[model samples]
Target chain A: QKEVEQDPGPLSVPEGAIVSLNCTYSNSAFQYFMWYRQYSRKGPELLMYTYSSGNKEDGRFTAQVDKSSKYISLFIRDSQPSDSATYLCAMTHLRGGFKTIFGAGTRLFVKA
Target chain B: EPEVTQTPSHQVTQMGQEVILRCVPISNHLYFYWYRQILGQKVEFLVSFYNNEISEKSEIFDDQFSVERPDGSNFTLKIRSTKLEDSAMYFCASTLSQGPPLHFGNGTRLTVT
Candidate 1:
């Protein structure tokens, strides 16, 4: 099984709509979860980060992790055209060193 | 806001030719990594460098691939003999510490024909 799995959705949503992106992992040892946004031909940019099994909010972005279910999610509120990008979920174990696993990004298109 | 920077935003090379992708990571960051994303595929971790040594690497980082922190500020990934499958967007990233959010460069899009 892949360590991390995510739906590669070309999800289309109207501007101002809420967006939810998710990923699931099979590794029970993962402790750090992150969300990265990548624009076409650009590198991945860190959008949100969360440690352990809790929720962390920053501005319109919120990241949540559930260690029990090995799931993580990113919620974008009041989405804008600027939010139209590929969202990738990443996770790593606290003691796994520098090897972080990334998911196949979900392509989101926020229509203006 | 300091950010990682990569050179040669795009590269095209013939199979069997050597290629080197360069990066200048955030000055204060200590950990650096190399990742690649093939077209329509997920981003995959290639290797990590710390303290001027390779801390970890994935299976994809084979003998044909190597990394070097030649200087205090510059890090690079060198592929001895490139293959068509080597075509992808190579990204350089760095973090202040373990478990910290990684700051990535704009990436070098490599096309091996």
Candidate 2:
């Protein structure tokens, strides 16, 4: 199994819809979880970050981590076309340094 | 907000040629990383540098690939001989502290033909 797995979603939704993207990991050692948004041909941009297990909210985006279940999720509320992008879930263990593991991003489309 | 900057937004090189991709990470960041994503594939970590030395690297980062921090400001990745399969988007990233979320540069699109 891959260390981190995310659905390669070409999930389409209308503007103002709630979008929930999720990823599951087989490694319980992962402590730092992050969500990044990438536009076509552009680099991934950090959207939300959380440590261990808990929920973090920032404006229209929320990140949730369930360490016990080895699951993580990013929730987008009232989505906009601007939110159309690939969402990547990344995790890393706090060992020697910060060597990270990434998932195949889920592509999202917020249509107008 | 301070951001990482990369040079030569796009590059095209012939097979067996050497190419150097450059990046300028956030000045105060301590950890630097190199990652690449082949079209339609997941992003893969290449190497990480800290304290002026290579802290860790993946199996994909072989002798043919080398990273250097020549000065306080610039981090570069040099491919000894580019291959057609080496064509991909290379992203440079940095973190303020170890185990923190990494901030990425715009990336350099490298096309090896």
Candidate 3:
């Protein structure tokens, strides 16, 4: 099985709607979870980061991790057209290593 | 307000030629990394560097690939003999410490013909 799995969603939502993106992993050792935003032809930008199993919120974005279920999510409230981009979920262990694994990004489109 | 920067936003080269992609990481950061993403694939870690040495590298970062911190501010990834399969978007990233969230550069699009 792939270490990390995410839906390659071209998920479309209207402006002002709430959006939820998620990923699941098989590695129980993962302690760092991150969400990255990438526009077409651009590099992935770190948007949200969380350590262990908890919720972290910044402005209109919220990241949640459930170590028990090996699931992680990014929630975007009041989505805007400018929020249209690909969302990638990544995870790594906290042992000072470099084996960060990334999932296939979910493509998002916020319509007018 | 600083960000990682990569040069030669786009590059095209022959399949057998050697190519070097360059980056300048955040000045205060000590950890550097190299990653690549194929057109529609997930971003994959290639290698990580710290204290002028490779801390770790993935299997994909094999004999044909090398990374260097040639100067105080410059980091580079060199592919010994590029292949059509080597075409991808290469990104440079840096972090303040181990396990920190990495900041990534815009990336260099390498197209091998």
Candidate 4:
């Protein structure tokens, strides 16, 4: 199985709508979860990162991790056109060294 | 905020030629990495560097692929003999420490013809 899996959604949402992006992993060892936003051909930009389970909030972005279920999610509230980008879920184990696995990003289009 | 910066936003070369992609990571960061992304695929890890040595590398990093921090401020990936399959966006990333949430550069689009 792929270490990390995510739905490659071209998810379209109206401005101010809430957006939820998620990913699941088979590795029980994953401890650090992160969300990265990529605009077109640009490189991935770190959006939010969480070290433990539950939720970590930064402004309109909230990142959640469930180590028990090996699941993670990123919730964007009151989304704006600027949020229209590909969102990729990434995670790594603190003990696994520097290799962080990335998910196939979900494309988001926030219509203004 | 200081950010990683990659040079020559785009590079095109012959399949058998050697190509070097360069990057300047955040001044205060100590760990550096190289990643690749095919046109429609997910970003994949290539290799990671710290303290002037390779700390970790994925299967994709083979004999043909090599990374070096030639100087204190520059990190580079050199493909010994590029193949058509080498065409992709090569990103250079770094973090203050060895872990998740890497800060990435805009990337260099390599086209091997």
Best by lDDT: 3
Superposition error at B70 for model 1 (Å): 0.9
- B7-54, model 1: which lDDT tens digit per residue? 999999999999999999999999999999999999999999889888
Question: Residues A1-112, candidate 4, lDDT per residue (tens digit)?
Answer: 9999999999999999999999999989787899999999899999989986989999999999999889999999999999999999998876634788999999999999
Q: In model 3 chain B, where is the ten-residue run with the lowest total lDDT? A: B95-104
Residues B1-113, candidate 2: write the lDDT tens digits.
99999988999999999999999999999999999999999989999999988988999999899999999999999999999999999999999888777999999999999
Residue B43 miss distance in model 1 (angstroms): 0.6
TM-score, prediction 3: 0.98
Per-prediction CA RMSD (Å): 0.9, 0.9, 0.8, 0.9
Instruction: Mark the 10 consecutive residues where model 3 chain A has the least summed lDDT.
Output: A92-101
Please give the TM-score for the first chain of candidate 4.
Answer: 0.96
Interface RMSD of each: 1.2, 1.1, 1.4, 1.3
- True-vs-predicted CA distance for residue A95, candidate 3, Å: 2.8
Candidate fnat values, all: 0.76, 0.72, 0.70, 0.76
Ten-residue stretch with the least lDDT total in model 2 chain A:
A93-102
Cand. 1: chain B TM-score:
0.98
Candidate 3 pairs with clashing backbones: none
Query: What tens-digit string does per-residue lDDT give for candidate 4 at B18-89?
Result: 999999999989989999999999999999888888888999999999988888899999999999999999
Q: Give TM-scores for every candidate, taking all chains together and pairing residue i with residue i.
A: 0.97, 0.98, 0.98, 0.98
The local distance difference test score of model 1 is 0.93
